[model samples]
Target: MVLLSCLQRCIQLLIWPVYILAYMGLWDSFYKRVFPYIMARFAPIYNQKVCKQKQELFSNLRKFAGPSGQLRLLEIGTGTGTNFQFYPPGCQLTCTDPNPNFRQFLLKSLSENPHVQLERSVVASGENLHEVPDGAVDVVVCTLVLCSVTNVSKVLKEVLRVLRLGGAFYFLEHVAADQSSWTYFWQKVCDPAWKCFGDGCSLSRETQKELEKTNFSELNLRRIHVAPRWSPTSPHIIGYAVK
Candidate 1:
C-alpha cells in the first residue's frame, strides 16, 4: 500500500512540472483563478466544521471598537471573505490577499454580509503588508494563512506593526501533528507536493511555535482537533493575541 502511494506521488510530482511549463509561468494565474471556485464548493463544509470555533474566536469584537463606534479590522489572506459572517455589525474591514482573483468573490461575500463595510482590498502577501500603515488597525485576523506564508514569524511581525496599541491579532490555522504520530510522518512526506498544488500551503508547519516565539503581549492560543489524529489538518490552533 505504501509503495503504491509513493508511486502515485512520484507520478504526480513528475507530471506537475510539465503542467506548470505548459502554462508558461501562468500557473499562478490559473491556480488563483481556479482556487476560488474550488473554495466556493468547499467553504460550506469547512465553515460548518469550524463554525463554533470561529464564533468563539470572533466573539465580542465590538469591545475593540474605537471612539467612532466602529472596528478597524484588517484580514490577511482574506480569500473570499469567509470570515465576514462572523464579524460584528460595524466593522470597516480591510482585506488582503496575494491573489487578485479572490477580489471578485470577496466582493460578493461583502455584498451578502451587508453589515460589514469594505475598506479596501489590497493584493499583498502576509509577510509584507506595506500597503497598510503602521498601527493603523485595531484588529488583525488571519485564518488558514500562516501555513502558506514563506515566513510565519515575519508575517506575525507585520501583524503587530499594523495593529494599534492594545489591539488584537486573531488567528486560526492548521499545524503539524505530534512528531511521533503517523499523521506527522505523512505531513512531512506530503508537504512538498502539497505546496505545489495547495498554493504554497505547507502541510507540516509548526505555526503554534512561531506564535509563541512572537512578541505578542498576551497569547491566548489553544489547539483543537477538528479531525481525527490520522488527518493532516487534524490539530488546529484557534485564538487571539493582544498586541
Candidate 2:
C-alpha cells in the first residue's frame, strides 16, 4: 500500500506542472463563472455527512447568543454562503470573503435562506479582519477557511480579538495528515498546484495546531473524514472553543 501510494504521488507530482500550467490563463474566468455553479450544486451533497456536527455548533451558538435572541455571527471566508442553510434562528450574520466574486453567489443563498439575517457583507480578507470591531461578536464561525489564509496565527489572533468574553470560534477545517502517511507527503508535493486552483487553500495546513496556539479559554477539537474523495484535503477538524 505504501509503495503504491508513493508511486501514485510521484506520478502526480511529475504531471502537476502540466495540470497547473493549463489552468493559469483560464483560472480567473473559471473561478468567476464556473466555480459558483459547481459550489451551489456540490455544497448540499458535501454537507450531508457534516451537517450534524455543524448543527451542534449552531445549537451552542444559539445558547450563547441568549435572550435578545441575536447571535452576532461573523463568518470569515463565507464562500458562496454554503453554510446559510445551517445557521440557526436569530443569527445577525456578518459575512466576509476575500474574493469579491462570491458576493453575488452569497446574495443568492441569502435570498433562499431568509432565516439568516444579513447584518453586513464585507469584502475583507480573514488575515486582517479590518472591517470587524474588536470584542463585537458573539461567535466567530470559520468553516473550511483556516487553510488558505496568508497567516493562520494572525487570523486566529484576530478571531480571538474580535470575540467577546465567553464568545466562541467555530471551526471546521481540513488539516495536514499524520507525518508518516503518504497523504502527508502528497499534500506537501501537490500543495502549490492545489493552492493555485483552490483559491489559496493549503492542503498541508494543520489548522488545529494553529488554533491551539491562540489564548482561548477552551478548545474541543476532533478529527473526522468527509467525502467526494478529495484526497489530502478530506481529513478535517470540527469543534468550538470559547474565549
> What RMSD value applies to candidate 1?
2.6
C-alpha positional error of residue 102 in candidate 1 after TM-score superposition, expressed in Å = 0.8
Candidate 2 lDDT for residue 67: 49
TM-scores of the models, in the order given: 0.92, 0.85
- Angstrom error of the Cα, residue 58, model 2: value is 2.3
Cα RMSDs of all predictions?
2.6, 3.5
* lDDT digits (tens) for residues 119-171 of candidate 1: 88899999999999999999999999999998998999999999999899999
What tens-digit string does per-residue lDDT give for candidate 2 at 55-108? 776666676683476789999989788788888865899998877777788989
